[model samples]
Target: MKIFKERHFFRLVIVLLLVSMASCNKKKNSYTAVSELDKKTFASTQLIPDDHFLGDASCKTCHAKEHDYWQGSHHDKAMQVATDSTVLGNFNGIEYKSQGVKSRFYKEGSAYFVNTEGPDGKYHDYKIEYTFGVTPLQQYIVKFPNGRFQCLRTAWDTKKHKWFDLYPDFKVVHSEWLHWSRGGLNWNNMCADCHSTNVRKNYDEATHGYDTKYALINVNCEACHGPGKDHVEAARSLGKDYKGNGDLKMTSQTKPKALVDACARCHMRREQISEYYNFEGSMLDHYFPQLIVENVYYPDGQILDEDYVYGSFVQSKMYHNDVTCTNCHDPHSLKLKFEGNKLCAQCHVPETYDTPKHHFHPTGTESSKCINCHMAGRYYMGNDFRRDHSFRIPRPDQSLKYDTPNACVQCHKDKDNQWAWEAYVKLYGKPKHKHFSDLLAPGLRGEAGGLNHLLELAKDTIYPEIARASAVNVMTNYADPQVIDNLLHFLKDESPLVRGASLDVLGEINAADYVNYLLPLLEDEKRSVRVKAFFALGSLDEALIPEPYKAVYKKVKKEFETNLKVTSDFVGGKVKQGNYYLKQGKLLDAIASYEAALEIDNTNNIARTNLANLYYRNGDFANAEQAFKTIITQEPEYGQTYYSYGLLLAELNRVEDAIVQMELAIKYMPDNIRPYYNLSLLYDKANQLNKAESTALKGFKKSPQDESMLYILAYIYSKNNEVEKAKNIAKRLVDLYPNNSNYRAFYNQLNAVQ
Candidate 1:
């Protein structure tokens, strides 16, 4: 099986690369340009018909060999409606229990179904409408008429020889904003755009629904190959003139940038702007570029947050050395393009790498695999797993400090980092490498503990750009005037990625001096660097910097406009317009814009979030809560969403629900003192005086200088009749924000009560 998979991968690589090389000339031919330009001039060009979209079915006629190969690939079964042949789990009445909650899965003839407890604690039998995958685990879906579907925690019981609930006891609450009733787990909109062929999510924001159209569902070949209508029509007209090479000859195969754009669509960890975008379009136009940070990754660029495939790859030395995705992966089969040791031997010769002398492992041992020591496995969620793609050396030193698993200890799970480190040292004999370890050692060991080492590393060119960028993040935790100075220097760094990273750190400091330093970088050559600089300036003082940097801001603004012009004229444009209206405080305008934007792309969480905030401000708590819930479901890691949701829950008198949301907010963002302070207020309102006092104290301890916590503590103490303590804290708050009427009012009240 492995050998066959490898051979398939190699053939895919050869075909894809050859196609890419052939289409390397990105400049459009005169005739092609004239044709496109002419189409643009004709207003009534009919805008292409939906039926023109030929799903994967059409490709089978000319590319029989490739189509057959893909039929057995995982990509083929990536998503399907739940049925006897497609479903792989044991659905013959299997039951499982977790946390005292019971769930049952069973099949009736060809239909699969699961009986599980809902969030409200009632047993319900939901029919499994779709099956998601055929792998270590598969997800089942339950559909609704609104073109929304919920991914049931329950999965097919393939091994158990019966149907089993994947989420036996876990309860997932429905948020107003989530579309959980459409196609179920058919990968309709959420996972389909990148995985399948041309997918169009025809959503209607007014009705809060999707079009009940079959054409919009599933992956299609034209998705990656551009509009196959043109190619197909040409093939029919020219007959023998067109070559049917059984390769991915889509538009993306024409150029390196185009190929990278298509592959990165799914492989990279990025923030999506539009709900959907075309494969031939630029990635930056629709997605926010990911950085090496705690939110997206560990400081060391190891996977910490989510499975962002492209982000990890960009940080690797291999990427810098001109390695492309097609070099290893076959686009058609979506599998590795080479087999066994031979695959690794493509770049690493057997003369240098095949022996135990290089790998230091016995022949045929599990560790003998090329990826075992280099690409460590990291578990995401509780079940979904992935391996690091950065292709970095294992850092045993960091593994010991952060308890982050290292590649060395991962394969040798029983061994400690020390054991692995000693073995590595004995074999390699302390060879020098450019890693952040030298700078991180001091902070990791709790020695020489300010931002000194971090600042030095940020200024050092000897370290890799990614490592230096990582150091900027650590500096923010212990930011000082000197650290800010170092960051200013980084703004001028040659690498736009590094400059962008520096701006992020500068934003964290909230320093006026650093904001001034970033004004010039807004005009940097790279669009990413310019975007980061603008966002950083917005964070520092949005009102003030706009005028001073107006000239450069206008230039960068055009990049966004250009992106909108070239890309699909749908969700992307509406989202940018909505955000613009939002930042300008045109609430009604923003709402209308978001409504329009949602019509183009209902899965856009940012639009939903902003709309929710607008609803909350208008006292429409029900709608506000729903929007927040949708944001949470789509992106649980967005800590602030929970914080906002908790506030609305409190207003609705859902104290328990509010508390849970606030706790989740704290879990994701421990450094933010606001959630802790808000949680304490809820405790105080509930008359849990001791808990309220403790929670408030915890916030104060985390941010001793924060006046809000001080005020909250004083209020709690005053309510408890502890006048002396209340007066002291209130007096301190008055000194902090003297002009504030609320603090003075609280101070006087405390003094009088005393």
Candidate 2:
């Protein structure tokens, strides 16, 4: 998976380099033209007809069995107005205390209420508006003015039958957006889209309000199929004589891709293009799924955060074999097609896979369950346990080597990875096939041969698009010529994921010379692709864009702006807007965007950190310092904040204070080599030879292949009268960069020294 490294670290390093040396135009002619800009043919744009959503009720007459099966299912009961029957929580004036806050859930005259601290940190009697989810846990939703509905942090565990806090350990302040009264926990913006059918978040960015609308209160028949108006019309015209296919455009068993797209619309963590989603065309045209990035997924593509199922399922061999969501899951009831191991037996021979000999465990135990080894479960939302849909084998060997979590070790807490590894080989023997994680884990961490392996993986068509995209993104850390070439090549990849991820890397590199290459993507079929291209072109000079591409850029730019505004109700959207404005050199607009994000979510560290950097960019040092100080006070362990603050302090000539911050950054981020390089330089400037030499040597030890670090270490060693060490380091640099005369001359001089 692509690791989201701290951008400030790169900014610091780049600032130290001469601008001309890092100029994109230096080798512009070296790249060959792949092809002329060809306008892509997109899927036909179709809007839902008026009164299109007939809801699940309309399907009852003909599809009685399907309709009956859907009733009282998880999807059917996803959202419900709080009532005597629907509510599962205790509402008898029971007070629950968590994180020093006392909340009382009670009932009065058929009304359900919760007395809890609201946005202002004062107790308020908030009426329970709705019940969200019907599973291991169920949360209550409270409505506020301006069309906002927030899900309570405390939910009733249906299994345990007790109220529990989702974030039991964190003391969330009332002013924080995560405190349930704010945007982070807002049901209308975040949860409503997935929970209901045909939901529209009519957000007004100007007013910061949502006039949300929905066709159905819960997931229904039309949610899986397209809007039913056209189908209904065709069926009525036939009048009980419809013997043919009825020529309905709605997704069905015939269209596997469309069906998966329909399921992924809600099942994936994605950014939606419009208020409405359809079961036609590419899902990428309307929504951009979250890539296998850090925090969201482990480097080995295991579930880390609440990714739902789409991302993991797409990586599985079953998906490549054209296994749609409906293959395993019953579409209407949202349950497995068969009980227990029977699901696997449908695909694999029962004699080979469903026996004790294959499973290596006694029959009828949890360990013998197919899901226990292949589809490992992770506990989420305090009580819910969601299994990984990737269906990968347990690799305890990888767990030991790469420090990645393994299903075997996860279940066998009393046993170590070595024991699990030995047991695995003893039972099933060594792995016969290479997994994507083997390359991905090392590539993402910048370990030995990472750059080449990632580049190869990105270009390999056989791997999943998500893994390939991740490989392209991991190339960003290397900043090599081959990385740039590979990234540009991926822009033309068939999958939208690869193309979009390539654009992300392009934006970071500021590839001004690739303006022509990026311009054509503005008119790409997918909205996600177009949006990524627009952002990638943020660094390109507007005037330099050819006249033919100007109109297209303007249209896509507006689309991108509208996309940002659609999610402006959340802090993340504001941060994206801030980044866009900042890239476009709209200082005031960027400042306003960041400030607005902070206003919505007071404890948003990312927004605060970026705001501080912007203040420093605008030469407002006092505010920058204050912002950094606030972050330090709020999150002392955050290494990126300290690293950025150290850079800011150094820029302002507070060398002594900067050194302290740099030390803290290193203390928090030991693996990062930037702090060591800068700290060594700082110590040298302060005339502390021993500290400078030691720090330089430490950086060199950490990154032996890093040319800059090697040069610094060589210089430091020479200064400290360590001629042999200097010669050895300089010789390695010369060997690495044989064409560079400076390195060769430096090596010769060091070698000649006594």
Candidate 3:
């Protein structure tokens, strides 16, 4: 009976194996058939054929005049082969070194080759197959055949006349960021979308790679003007008759909004939704839509940062006056529509504004220019030169009070804001302009002058909505019943942002009487306003909210819950929920939510980083280390993660590992201060006295006023036996933190030692 059972079992196993093999084969065949069908379907609906991207030679067939204008524009040579005609820098085997790294740019007959310093501290010779950009900054491109064509991070140094490395040495340490074997230096993912025309980053989900190629690799006129294929064909088929029918020009004559849309595609720093390709469909569709002044300007409307395109243009009265792009710039040539003062003269009378009498400088001198006085500002890079586009008078009073930049001090580098203010007072003598500057002065000095301005600004329609939002700063200082009542009126403003701001300001009052007024705003049309209202409602007395409003709040809350449920299938919804939880300080809940999301979709690195941050914040060092390590392994190019991990490691008391991690962090996120501060502390603990002092000094130089950084510097100086320096720092710390007895005692001890 036992022998019979064993034989039966063996037969059963064999039958099961045979059935599994047949099922596997069937699935393989089915997958192949389905893939083929999908390919066919995709091909049928593809926007443009692979062969449709004809070179410039084919474009010159009919529209010779248009082609001639394009040649002079920056777009024509935006990218080209590194021939003598295109290559700007002296590439005669010139070697350049920067930050302890070296690179050599040389030409071999018709071809250009560069031995560049890779991220790993090794010099690699890559053949320059293509050159990108025409002015400001240009990059070299090289193809790896089976791999991808990568744009080298090192750009040609035009002034220095050599090629310079842009990345640090540690980036090449077998990390994902520097691995040339895996298509390392491809700018297609980072920058190609804005620079190219009809770019399609055909990313394959299965392969996890991009099959990127472009119709035109630079910002062509056709890119902004729409595809010139149809227009060109029409012009060729029928001469001047093609005017209104086929030729769609992106000019003042055509759809004016198209020009702004074209510029905004690249210029505005908004989030991108789709792959870098798909220009027609991939632009930023939705953004945080409150038109706050800070979103567009500094508090004083002065250009504070490198917000070049949007900030200046949006603030100009030109935008309000319906002045389109073509009014200032010629689309074909891309130069200013007129030369010198003529550009400004288009709007302002030259006799009144452009003369030396008005500018108060010698004619033909640099300071005599209208841009020099009205729009004088600096660009962000090493070169602190370049005027601003926002044409406004220099309010030297605001500049003196707030230390904001002014047009006068820009040219007269020898003079301070005080000098400029005195000069302006002598010239113009304090005009009573109804600008926000007049309002912010008193608020900045901790006075109540902002109250009256806030009241006036809330009523004025001419002032931007942003100026009214600035009133929140002054509201913290002095309470005015009139201001509060006016803000209440804005609770029902047509703009959701204004209503949201009003709700936020109402929280300061915490008044039971205004609870009824705030309750209805909880059901605002905008999601952001509703979210703000929910929090504001939490601040008010529960009894004050009527039963009807409570029901409305519950309904709105239910709608959000239902929407979250419906969209929870996608990663975006999970991310949104995680953000909401993070903002509300529910850190552990956010971590769990993000972790669950990653379990469903492992490719979600954003969730992984967010979970790591939560763990770091909660003091769960072990989990934070594991999470950061996992992310580092998957994506080493993300340097900020390494810095965060180093911070966590330091908290864990793993000093040596912390040092190594901090070094790596500094190697990537060089500008960050946390790693430097922690590194200095670790060095002091290890008795590396000189290193600690140097690191602390560096940290102090970066952030002199940071209390923790000051404390660290003081401690480092004391350890180095510099009693005087240490006492000075301790005194500063004591002054900053007068309530802290520990700091006071430390300061006393330092003074005694000194």
Candidate 4:
């Protein structure tokens, strides 16, 4: 039996279920009633004099129906004060143990307290300031000095009614930034913007603190419908002297795309651009949605991590077909409009879809469900089974070939992928080779036939923009002329995502080559496109850029810089700022930024590694060596760190030490080709022909089409008198790149020699 195994792609699954919890209430059309169980655990909306934020209470007086429906919703109880009524967990001096650490949850008088291992790696009695989220799981937020609220590692499983560790697989030490007590889990920076309305993350970069303020404690009507001040004023002037139509700045956006973008501000896996923004413009203006890439998503665009919904939904046919989050789900109550097959029948014809012929399962069985086949669920946070929003069809054939999860075998725990694939073929006939997954899988793996397939997928307007952009992103690693040409064309694509992704790819390439090409993008309509254009231009030599374009660059560059500043309190933002500075050739500023990131979260390995690389690049060998050593000692499993350290050692003329580090890098990341190529070259330079040949051949086994590895292997084989092997490699290389003069010349030379 081929049971599905979770990969190590997501180091930590921080599943923040932005949407409402699952509902069993069989409401047909009317809004799901909010009972006593549904009362929003957090504070409700109230009118404030100066502030634009009118709490749920303010709206309830007029829009009582919406208020009642939204009362006990996920947004309503996103976070609340840890009180007798609010605290869901058993805090009656109960002890929960995991990984040699014991935490006691107890209540003193009316206050909830937890005696747990803190940031200092010692047990401390920390007051539960707030209860963050309630559903399959509920986490407690503990306030620290420096105005930080961190979600505790241990969470209460609401469904199971038991305590469970968020990171059950590993014992995260207190000192690590990923530890519950650190800034990585800080509520103000990570969770507050989405959970609350009119949130201003007043993060002080100089003070290294947050004076974070929010209008409403929970996501109220104004959160989605935009600020209610103008709407409320318009309502108040209803019978007074109101004009033709009250110019209410409400986001009553009926357009499917616009409405989704409004919701995406919270639901998307994205980066913040502005401190506070209403639903007035594009989501790309205020936040940059992360492209569907590895670590964040499966190669087939499945939700590999806790990528809420928007990222996956944007790639689905549903989003492209004008279907949105509100189509199936109630906009206010955030529950399904119908139950089971009836929900699918809302749009799809019941006779055509919700039957055994369509579902290919026994009627009324769990496998017969529409969601089971189309929207497979994956368990995150121990018990939270979130469904994949991509809504892809069951493709067990793809699963068998690519080792990705398929809905067919997800429920059939005792069946192998081959069994599922054969059954699917028998029932549905051979699946069409039309899915974006077919192209994306090869593109992500860097396998043969990827270039043409990916290029076609990218240019095809029929496919989802997110999927097309993802294709462009994966094609970035390839140096094909068509790849660059297609990317250049995509720079002018109508979709902001495509343009932004193309710019990201071109920026990594020779930025000077596309300097004039990306100049017009500085004034691009989308903020994401404009910022990416600025980034691409910023990569070039300042003097090489035209005078007229420099002004455009400066204006957009300020926006980019301000975006970084707005999020500088977090480790990720600081690291990004450091990278930006590094690209700008400000080594000291880059170093300072990285150092600042470490100050905020001491266990930020990316910052540490980047700092080490900078030190090495700047010729500070001593510090670089120390930094690399610390990283290796602390995070030995991180292959990239070892690979970087190997390069540093090589530069220092410590070839033997470099070789060892490179070998370790290969051990951890076998699929990585850089270490193999570099290690082989090092071996050849050291006159170790046997080791060089072995290393190159191993790399060839993993990535047979890798031109660099093939060249090195051919060279080593020819020098070692393995003429036949050298000629075979030469022939393959020439066949792969027929037009390449170098490959042809090398092949001819090898043939002549033979």
Q: Judged by lDDT, which candidate is best?
A: 2
Please report the TM-score between candidate 4 and the true structure: 0.87
Give the TM-scores of the predictions, in the order they appear.
0.63, 0.89, 0.58, 0.87
- How does candidate 2 score on lDDT? 0.77
Give one digit per residue, the lDDT tens place, for model 3 in 510-613.
53567777777755544445545665555444455677676657654543443343224234445555655654557887787777556434545667777887
Question: In model 2, how large is the Cα lDDT of residue 194?
Answer: 75
lDDT (C-alpha, whole model) for all candidates: 0.61, 0.77, 0.59, 0.76
Candidate 1 residue 626 Cα shift, in angstroms, is 18
Superposed model 4: Cα runs more than 4 Å off: 1-50, 240-253, 540-554, 666-677, 680-754
Q: For residues 693-718, could you state the per-residue lDDT of candidate 2 as single tens digits? A: 88888878887788878988888888
Task: Summing lDDT over every window of 10 consecutive residues in candidate 4, give the lowest-scoring window.
Answer: 10-19
Model 1 agreement with the true structure over 1-754: per-residue lDDT tens digits: 0000110011000000011111222322221222332232211111223564676667788978878777756667766877778878766787776555566878777788878765346678888877776665667777655676566545544444444444344443332222122222223444545544444445554565655333434444555554455556556766887674332344433555456645666666444433334321245434545555544566466777554567677667766666777778776786888866767777888878877989888877777877777777665423446778788778776666666667887777799999977887888866487565557445433354636776677677665565666676566665356766677878888755568678766654454556668788766644455655655554343446558677567655554443333222244445545555554556677677767756544556766777888887777777888888878877889899999889888988888888899989999998899999999999887888888888898899998878789988998888888899889898889898899998999788777762
Candidate 4: tens digits of C-alpha lDDT, residues 328-407: 99877889999888888888898988788888778888877788888987887777888998989878877877788988
**Global CA lDDT computed for model 4:** 0.76
CA error at residue 434 for candidate 3, angstroms: 3.3
Instruction: Find the 10 residues in a row with the least total lDDT in model 3.
Output: 10-19
Error of 3 at 647 (Å): 14
Per-residue lDDT for 351 in model 1? 72
